[model samples]
Target: MRQAPVSLPLGIVVRRTPSVSRWAPWAYKAVSVIPGAGAADWQVLREDGDVIEYHAATVPLELWHTDTEAYLAGLSARVPSIGVVMRDDDESAHPYEILLATASPYECQDYADSGEELLELVPMPEGLVALIRDFVEEHHEEEVFVKRRRDKKRIDEVEDGRGDPRITQLTDVYRAPRAGRPN
Candidate 1:
């Protein structure tokens, strides 16, 4: 049986703080995600001293039936988190562009492996957690472990193909070509 995919609109909360170093002016990171949030793009939420928080962007947080196993892994974690994926954007006002929000830790690892993307693990909201838990419960099935048995055929019975087929002599068939030897 196939199940339809689920999705929710999530708003990414990004915080930018003044950097202490002279090389960079600001440091940006995704702090949290708001579930069922409307469209937003770098809208300022708060400002204090040199720190500023913005509702960076709203993106679809999708949940697939096939990825329920990954979601299960995230739910069981010590601190269940939502992976916020962002990418660098030079032309945009913000340093990074919010790409997506995901509940799967496995998918988060994939984004992290890319190294080009900025990935953050924000604590999952209680409501979001409950929603994912319900989805996982419905779609996730405990996969059975099946050990694979080796083939019964004996490979030693066949003649190895490593020997040169052109050499008619059985003894010299396996002889490797020497330097300056024409054959």
Candidate 2:
């Protein structure tokens, strides 16, 4: 059976409640400095619990854009040492929004300004990948979906059951495992 492409790496969304002493927007700026911070949408919630949690949502990297990076950078620059719970206007436009915090706001801002929507270039450590994969596997169910086809035409035009022999030979050569033989 064919498998779906491995799911894209997860982008974490973090949220924090504003402290009573500080303004909500400023709170977000404050939080952007602690290491492992990323862009997030903020909301004032009345729920009971800790002020923040990690891995609140595992979203496709494509959903996050350079604007998130800029916002994070601006937040980090504004408050170099603390994590603040700031209100994010960008989330309002999306169907679902998650609040997140990041350590480097400048990097976030740079990414946003570049018009890039994906964030996977930043390699994730193995532990974090495991954490995210576990979260997704536990909370989400996989569905089999139709695969999209590429635009390129097939090299073989003949209707014969056999394919081009050259293709199989090339594939065999390319896919052969590295040297270390049992034979």
Candidate 3:
């Protein structure tokens, strides 16, 4: 029988950067909001037992048997960061319309990053990491990497099948006009 998949809890950290308005006077706002200097909001959109029991915002992490290994690889990074898809609407009129969070580095690479979208490398909450580790231990099967060897074939000196130039040797060079009549 197959074991039922479980939804895990993942903690998200959002970092907000401060900046001065485009038309700010030179003096009043001399000290603009420093980039990477701001408050952090912790939200886990899920509520499991004691694991998700933390009274904070969280998202339910659903892991399938197939995706468990990949997800585990992402979480295994030295500095694991949840990719958040957030919209940056300062220049435009769109508000809160952006990609929130992604789970993998590969996905983050392809994630469209605009000046508006904020991407942060927030550490994964210990509780959430522990929760994911438990699920991975139970469902994730480590795939051993094996290098494949190319097949070796015997090389013939002459009269080879496809590589044989003798087979395609021109028999009647004169009779076979370059661009005259059909052969």
Quick one: best TM-score, which candidate?
1
Give the distance in Å from residue 46's predicted Cα in candidate 3 to where it truly belongs: 21
TM-score-best of 1 and 3: 1
lDDT of all the models against the reference? 0.90, 0.37, 0.47
Q: What is the TM-score of each candidate against the true structure?
A: 0.86, 0.25, 0.47
- Judged by lDDT, which candidate is best? 1
- Model 1 per-residue lDDT tens digits across residues 1-183: 776679899999999999888999999888999999999989999999999999999999999989989998999999999999999999976689888899999999999999999999999999999999999888788889999999998877645335766767646556566668797
- Candidate 3 yields a Cα-based lDDT of 0.47
True-vs-predicted CA distance for residue 23, candidate 1, Å = 1.5
Q: Give the true-structure RMSD of model 2.
A: 18.6
29-132 per-residue lDDT for model 3 (tens digits): 11111112222233233344423211122344455566676667778799665565554446653233334444555555556444445454445556656766
Where does the lowest 10-residue lDDT sum fall in candidate 2? 26-35
- lDDT per residue for candidate 2 within 93-138, as digits (tens), equals 4323333233234544554565533221233344543543444444
